[model samples]
Target: MSSLLKPFSISDGPCESGAFRHGVGCSKSLHSPAFDPTISHGATAPGCRTGTTRTRLGCTPGIYHTYSARRTLAAASTGGRKVTHPGKAILAGGIAGAIEICITFPTEYVKTQLQLDERANPPRYRGIGDCVKLTVQDHGYRGLYRGLSSLLYGSIPKSAVRFGTFEMLANPMRDETGRLDNTRSLWCGLGAGMAEAILVVCPMETLKVKFIHDQVSLAPRYRGFFHGVREIIRDQGVRGIYQGLTATVLKQGSNQAIRFYVMNSLRNWYKGDDPRGEMHPIVTAVFGATAGAASVFGNTPLDVVKTRMQGLEAHRYSNTVDCAFQILRNEGPVAFYKGTVPRLGRVCLDVAIVFVIYEEVVKLLNNVWLTD
Candidate 1:
């Protein structure tokens, strides 16, 4: 009878074995460090042990704690919690952006060049390889990274705001069960996209597009990133910096909505109960690439409009509607997807790297600070 009652005693005190009632090895709890206050444990949560301990996968002893910390941060960021720590999100996103830009800016420059080219202007290069060969022939390999400085300036803050805002907004709209549904994920993404578009992407893209567009000219007026910025402000005024605000908003909003929705769907499908369950790094990268590709196809038309509106010859078009109409009428439908191949490659690789870095950085931060 006493043995029968032992299971009931777990809620109040240690069992007859005279050990603390936590985890599979109750005796180990008494000798371990003090309980971490920052971590919340569900006494009867699925897959969790007593107190704050969780069951480590593959029969490991201490790995559960590290995995639990990562899971908790992921959950909070992806709308499982009511709130998120913005500072950590910003830090993680900024570092991820800095890392991604250095590796991917050349592809971005090439994509921009391809998009801005036209057969009517006597096309400079036949295709992607020819473009690269001709660019190297005319301007050296360094020309592939002509507008990197502008991108770095924009991308850091743009990425920081994007992730930070998504985390902040996602939590509030979680379903009653505290799960992020596709609708909530999309809303969070759209809000983040719009925020970044208005604050950073517009001005930075203006400078970047102008710089890259003028790379074809023998006597380019915009010598550097700052010089271009000053000239735009001097001639077109500050409004010139926001040359493509409408198209940017549409493009970015749709881009993130598609990305987060698809990424979250993949995550939720893999981890039935917990959308933030840990996956192998390869799996995460694959999911990121898929989401990035989906976004590219969905919003490439808006991207075309944005590029035209922000170009040095932006005065040729009146607004987003006009830009789209002119492209359709003059450049034809194919022009809308002129840079699709380069963009698809750039975005897929960029998103994969950004997400993998962001998650790893967040995990590192969780290790450093108890509640971050």
Candidate 2:
């Protein structure tokens, strides 16, 4: 009988052993000395050992304590890592962008040249293969990177603004568990895209397009990045570098929204409920590539319009809507996807490289700087 009665003791109740069903009718009087009534409801009691059980219609003190400790640790770790630091994001993004542009500029050059080609009576190049052949033949292999300087100059700031803005916007959207949901991530991405477009991408893109177009022109005027920038400013003022602001914003905003939405969704799925989970670099690259492909398909039309608006012949089109209208009416709807193939390749590699580098850089920075 003493053995049977032993289980009813305050220190060895059914709650501690998880013997009670639904924790129903479990008396507070049977609670251990560690279970303080003065403690707030649903909070952990001091000195309680964690347990997978409930008591008095709520989680046992031990479970509450375990959960509380987990939350505290999560908060401390997150704070210590400074994951949302704008400066860190900017540095990482800039480094990633610089590296990515260097590796992928050839594809970017091809895409730009293709978009600028207006399907002349005698097309300058037959297709992707012909374009590459002619560029290499006429100007040597370096022609494949004709406008690299302009892109490199802009890529750093563009990516910096993008990631910095994203971290700033996303930090607030995270839940108590530090997880960012897909919808909020999409909005944050859009905001980051718009910010980067306005702050850096438009002028940089306009310069890049003009440089690439000039390279293929009968008389290539600009000698270098500075020279071209000066000439554009001398000829058209500051607006010359911002030729397609509206189109750029639209394209970039949609681009990031799609990429980040897909990326966040994939990450969430991969991580499940573990917000602090880390992914392998290869896995991150694959996810980034998928995200890039999604963005390319989703907004290639806007990208084409943006390219055209920033090209040498931009004056022919009045505005964003007019550019699209003319392309649809004269060039046919297919023209909207003119550089889809090259753009797809460049974007996939670019996104994958940028994300992988950015994540690794952030980790490095976290180790060096241990403050929020």
Candidate 3:
């Protein structure tokens, strides 16, 4: 009894979804014989399956006790109608991705350097500031973003697919399970991460690494993306490109679950401020910074493994476990967690950028979606 759901009443509205109401005992109409009106309606009556005329869906008199309690409300707002299911997610993703990239760019730049020069002096980049200064001093500001083109090539689409899938799948999955607990979030995150990893992420990531480590442009350097792709296939075989897929899955899956959980929880809490009441700029900034930092911190070890695994010279481990264990045995367990400082910086930047960007873009896309 203590664990039971406390009674909570949602404001009544004109429901229109084509769902059946139980016990409301059916429309004596022949078409929807199962249309019982006894149960509370989830939506308006379903459309005629065969274009049949409406049968009398009259309710029984005895069961239909009318409660005449009237209540006042401004309006039941679905928060600015949208054009498509993917629109909001895509907008959010774009915003998130843009922010993520900008904030994390420096950290990424350092990561690329570390991964490329595995044997470079100083081992991995020390602190975020040191890395930035070293990069600018040695390679120039351009060096700070050496692999940006490739990063964008993969990151944008990868993020779009990643978050879009998460949002879309989460919505439907929640509908199915009737809840959004951590389990649901995990599955949704897994599905989303896997989909993006295989499709958009793997190759783009490969390209980004190729650029960062090798200092080559995405295309032409090793042929084109396809040609480079072909070379990797010809030499290392198809599996080569997906070198760090498991690490990616680990990083992305966890990142997505935490990101979605935090963002959604916060959004729900703020729903009281309809018209998206403006939080203090500091609050937004802190949210963006903290979320990015949290995801980065949580997934840094995985990212390190993924980066090293992806950089696997010609012959490396055949599988994720092999690579992981090999690193642990040869380089020590700490090796698997290389680049923590940069990762911390990257995550902080990513979170701030993503949330702020996502919010702004959502607002814009909402306006646009509403118009169209």
Candidate 4:
């Protein structure tokens, strides 16, 4: 009779036999140092990438690292509890966002240029190459980054939603620090991508797209982020801010999904069998670069439509379909993906920075909170 009651008795007393009891200890451990699996397990040397924690793998290492990272986090993640690490995520997101915005602005400018056929003298731009040359000729090399001001305004919030939501959303799936698969990463990518699309992206992207594509402004060609917002609100009204929402949803959604999926996949594959924390940041960054390139290739077309739609006069196209058709008829197929290199660079940096920060911040939080 007592043997039948083993499961129920778990909550009645300490898990003296080292068995988890309804995972209460996982989060309960957060409040006390002794309960922490990570501290209890202890850290190994640099080469020991999760070598101490043995596990089987038919799955990628993102799962392994995610599972490993969760030792303390799982313990800390009791209902209504989380491993507080906002400061670290913020620092990482900020620095990475700034770098990504600066490096990618040129590509964004060129991409925007390709999509626009502003009804103007010489029809605005002959082609992407022509636009680049003209931009340099008229505004100097700096013209290639036409919307840096807006990018700065947009990048931080974009990154915050991406990284913050990724961390927050992925917290739901775990097997008491024992599961190993990239499931968490898939969810992270999906959640992060959706959060970014609906929130920060619709507006800043509209402004950047409008400013980059056309030399003229119905009101103002993004004089600044705030100025652009004011003009957009004053002239086109609030709904004017989301011109090609469907197209944007496709492009950025694919971008973020590819980014996290590939980034974590690489981390998992290279991490091999070892104690989890011993993974390499540089390797992860390189993987980010590759994943970013792949994502850009698939999603560039929708981005083109989104940009073109933003700069166009109302009724030019009711939605992304008309915008995409207009581009296909006018610019040919190649226009969809003109500024690939810069975007790849930007995405690579963004992914790397977010990963490092999230991981490092989580660790720092555990150390402080668990020790205190």
Ranking by TM-score: 2, 1, 4, 3
Query: In terms of TM-score, how similar is model 3 to the real structure?
Result: 0.66
lDDT of 4 by residue, 1-372 (tens): 877766432234575432334445522221122233432233323334432332243222222244446555755554323323444455456566766677566766765664455432356666667777888998799778777787788788888777777656555553333233476776667668877888878777887776665454444355666776787788878877876677777777777877777776776677644314345667656676688777777687776666666675546777788877766776677667655554555556656655665555556556665531
TM-score per candidate, in order?
A: 0.79, 0.81, 0.66, 0.67
The most accurate candidate by TM-score is: 2
Model 2, 209: alpha-carbon shift in Å?
0.7
lDDT of 2 at 158: 91
Write down the lDDT that model 2 would get: 0.85
Off by over 4 Å in 1: 1-84, 175-178
Displacement of the residue 234 alpha carbon in candidate 1, Å: 0.9
lDDT of 2 by residue, 144-175 (tens): 98889988988999999999999999987787
Per-residue lDDT value at 350 in model 3:
72
lDDT of 4 at 234: 89
Backbone clash numbers for all candidates listed: 0, 0, 19, 11
Inter-residue clash pairs, candidate 2: none
Rank by lDDT, highest first. Answer: 2, 1, 4, 3
Worst 10-residue lDDT window, candidate 4? 26-35
lDDT of 1 by residue, 1-372 (tens): 777766332324544332444575454332222245444332434554543443333222232354446556766666544334677788889999988999998888888888888645888777788888888898899998899999998888988999999988887676644568887898889999999999988888988999898888778888888888888799989998999899999999999999999987887788787654578888889999999999999999899889989987789988899989988988899899988999999999999998888888877887686663
Q: What is the lDDT of residue 33 in candidate 1?
A: 28
